[model samples]
Target: MKDMIPVDRKMSTMQDSKISARGVQVYYGETHAIKDVSVEIADNTVTAFIGPSGCGKSTFLRCINRMNDTIDTARVMGDILIDGEDIYDPRVDPVQLRAKVGMVFQKPNPFPKSIYDNVAYGPKIHGLARNKADLDEIVEKSLRKAALWEEAKDRLDKPGTGLSGGQQQRLCIARAIATAPEVLLMDEPCSALDPIATAQVEELIDELRQSYSVVIVTHSMQQAARVSQKTAFFHLGNLVEYDDTDKIFTNPQDPRTESYISGRIG
Candidate 1:
């Protein structure tokens, strides 16, 4: 496995990180998914992970929130620190950790419950609000942040599954943000949407970066270029290069990154 890159060496000194990973690796049974990958995620910035299928971009993203822990056969090694605290420590609760680091999947998996219920689920579980009024406020704030409040406000009682694809995805985003997480993880969030829907989600992602650190895994280089400040390119379970999005797209130091960007190979 390749040596992990030091976070301070890779990121700008001016940037303050929300999460710092060091010597991270992940495996599913005997299959190695991520190989000694380390990088810093700056607060209030969007970091994009781009690579071909099976390159472990999504795998690394899932590692941040301990999502891989749900898989019985999965094993993770090394330290992942959130606010300089290691998340993998036995004392750390995965459930609580997930509340601080929310995730949205590639597909919009809205609950069968009402639109209001969908957004309220996270806060309800995390005990973020006590009274009904407080819960309502939390839900509304979350929906507004996700840019879905105006569209869904009147239909709060309606089933989340009844909404349009893009609306449903936004509802999911609202749900993730309801807990007021410090970081948000998105795994190919716009993959299933049409061009217009994709654009809307992309815009929402940009708006979200104002308050939370975001790490997105996308197969589309164009989308990565458009939404992310920092970009990491993975190839064959290796993080081949990580740098500013402009540099990664325009003048990457690694031949592998250059070849993938130029369409020679992925």
Candidate 2:
């Protein structure tokens, strides 16, 4: 369905698509954390995933870059394709896959290195730069994209951990984009920021959609409405509703969706 050609064992060719999840399920040891979920994420758009705590929104987000694979007992069953390639394929390297599918977490985490080095880390490892000049350009471009270049340019050698929380988070975003990813997965990026910082990050998120497919998991409904063009509502591990931001917020077809939007359920 939807420009996809069926294949065997959780494999599919989703050409011209940014991200596609089919019959996705997740398990932690013996507990089933996510039920069968399916959705398609478009390129150059921001898709927000909203739900109550532990509703599997973040869990599903982690599946995109295989972050859950770090857990000893976390098992994922499904096909997650980006640009027609199956990320779970044996031939695919998770490190490289992560480069293509960058992520920013709930809390800002910058390496304990200079601001310049923090932004240049990914490019250095991925060989995106030819030399010091190239790395410097990449760092400057990434920081500008994250909207932190003007503030941090004078302090390039300063430790990234020395910046304010909001600046640190923006630094992390710069690092993520330095590798030139096609999809960006953010897990509640504004949860830890002040209102002003959140507003700035929100603005940056909107701008980022011009270059990459951004998928954000946010607890804030207003943030989702402001940043995303499409929205998906999850409940107790199931994807209850997915539609245009206006439709999902204004006139949801599903009762559960309406309840959540109306403050009846979460």
What TM-score does prediction 1 earn? 0.94
Point out where model 2 deviates above 4 Å: 1-16
Q: What would the TM-scores of all predictions be?
A: 0.94, 0.93
Give the local distance difference test score of model 1. Answer: 0.89
The 10-residue segment with the lowest total lDDT in model 1:
1-10
Candidate 1: where is the Cα deviation over 4 Å? 1-14
Candidate 1 per-residue lDDT over residues 1-266, each given as its tens digit: 01222223233343667899898889999999999998888988889999999999988998999999999999999899999999999999999999999999999999999999999999888888989999999999999988899999999999999999998888999999999999999999999898898989999998898888999999898888888889999999899999888778878999999999878887
State how far residue 77 of model 1 sits from its true place (Å).
0.6
Per-residue error for 75 in candidate 1, Å, reads 0.6
Clashes of 1: 0
Q: Write the per-residue lDDT of candidate 2 for residues 126-221, one digit (tens) a residue.
A: 999998999899999999999999999999999999999999999999999999999999999999999999989999998898888999999988
Which residue pairs of candidate 2 clash?
A: none
Give Cα distance to truth, residue 51, candidate 1, Å.
0.2
